[model samples]
Target: MITENQIHSLAKRWEIDQITVMREYLQILFLFYLYAQRKSDKIFFKGGTAIRFLFGSFRFSEDLDFTGTLESDEIIGLFNNACSDLNREIPAVEMENFKKKRNSIVSRIRYTPKPDTYPLGIHLEISIRERPITKAASHIETLLPVSPYPVVTHLESEEIMAEKIRALLKRAKGRDLFDLWYLLTKEVKLNWDMVKKKMEFYNDAATLTDLVSAVKAFNQKKLFDDLAKFLPRAQRKTIPGLKENILEKLGRFAVT
Candidate 1:
């Protein structure tokens, strides 16, 4: 619900484009809408988007990911009601292309915050495969001026790191690598036991050597291609050395 002037001002302040600012504002606005429903605690926020909004990662993410106990219908209901409230508050915003696979247990939607402009596409994935290892903690997100401080329910730093490690090992996406590097630079501790448990789910037996090899195998061009748009121009240079930096810091977590 920010004015055009406010969006431009925020773009200048954040050193990003107005389109990204608009997308992020709409994302925060949607999260606030969920908070307004008083069921925020039922879902545990995780992934790169959570890293950006909750932990202040420098990168931007396009999707909202969560692991929750809420049934699919309940989740959909909450989203539908939130979309109604959002459209009421900002008439320009529209929710479209909603679909939930019968078996994937994930829901997807797109939000166009402004007509005849870039549509802010958002994907919502809720995994109920297993319960979260750590209890959800409250994080008060107040970065954007789009809404008042909304407390988000999310996993602990260690648990988040564990999941990030699993994601890095499995997919090795630039975003996961960047998130892990950010967490490591911040000296966030890794819960090895939790890491192992998460790995077990994927049947991955990756060791320190395997993790090192995985980092080494990352294609720098792909890394840049994956993260360049999400990062500021100045920060794009850091992508080339992400693997080395991550390996240098990763050893501290070795269980030897």
Candidate 2:
């Protein structure tokens, strides 16, 4: 359990706004509860959040994304237990709603610390149908600024980069492009072998040529619009040339 002052202090230290800090705090709390319930072993954390929390990507993520092989009933129990345990620390935390889709579970969580104010919502998406092709190296523990407990398990960086590549080919979101550019700039090598396995699972043919074609067809304007809000004022200057920069960096990976 964290107090409002603690959250504020963390936000100050990070030089980010309080809401962002609070959201991250809630994310940490959820991760703690999930691990405590022994659900961490069942699923491997992935997507932008994983990149941010585990690998130190600067971009902020709005939702928690994961993939695993767990039944609906079991996942629900995990969430129920997590929410119940979380409430002990922060009474305002609640599981607002959860819907079971064919291949995923979309859950809405509300955190409202103040009585008169509206609650902040965070979505947790669990892809139950697909499991990780490349397993994480281990359950690595990470410390956050706001929380004392460490986020226990996260997928490997190479695996995350591979998934980002897959997402770049499949989705038009700018964050995917931005994440790839950031990872590559940091010299994180893509696991081409794992990328092929993930592509096969999605029934998409994986090849350097195919990836290049996808990058060539990406909508630069749409990517800019989708990612504008998330970028800092200084970083926003690069948006005009982001498409070209991303395409250039992506070209390097096409052969290797």
- Compare the candidates by TM-score and give the number of the best one: 1
lDDT tens digits, residue span 117-182, model 1 = 665677777766657887656655655675467677888888888888888888889898899899
Q: Runs in model 1 with CA error above 4 Å?
A: 96-104, 113-118
Model 1 residue 250 CA deviation (Å) reads 0.8
Which residues of candidate 2, in runs, are more than 4 Å off?
A: 1-15, 137-147, 254-256
Clashing pairs in 2: none
Task: In model 2, state the lDDT of residue 194.
Answer: 82
Query: lDDT values of the candidates?
Result: 0.77, 0.74
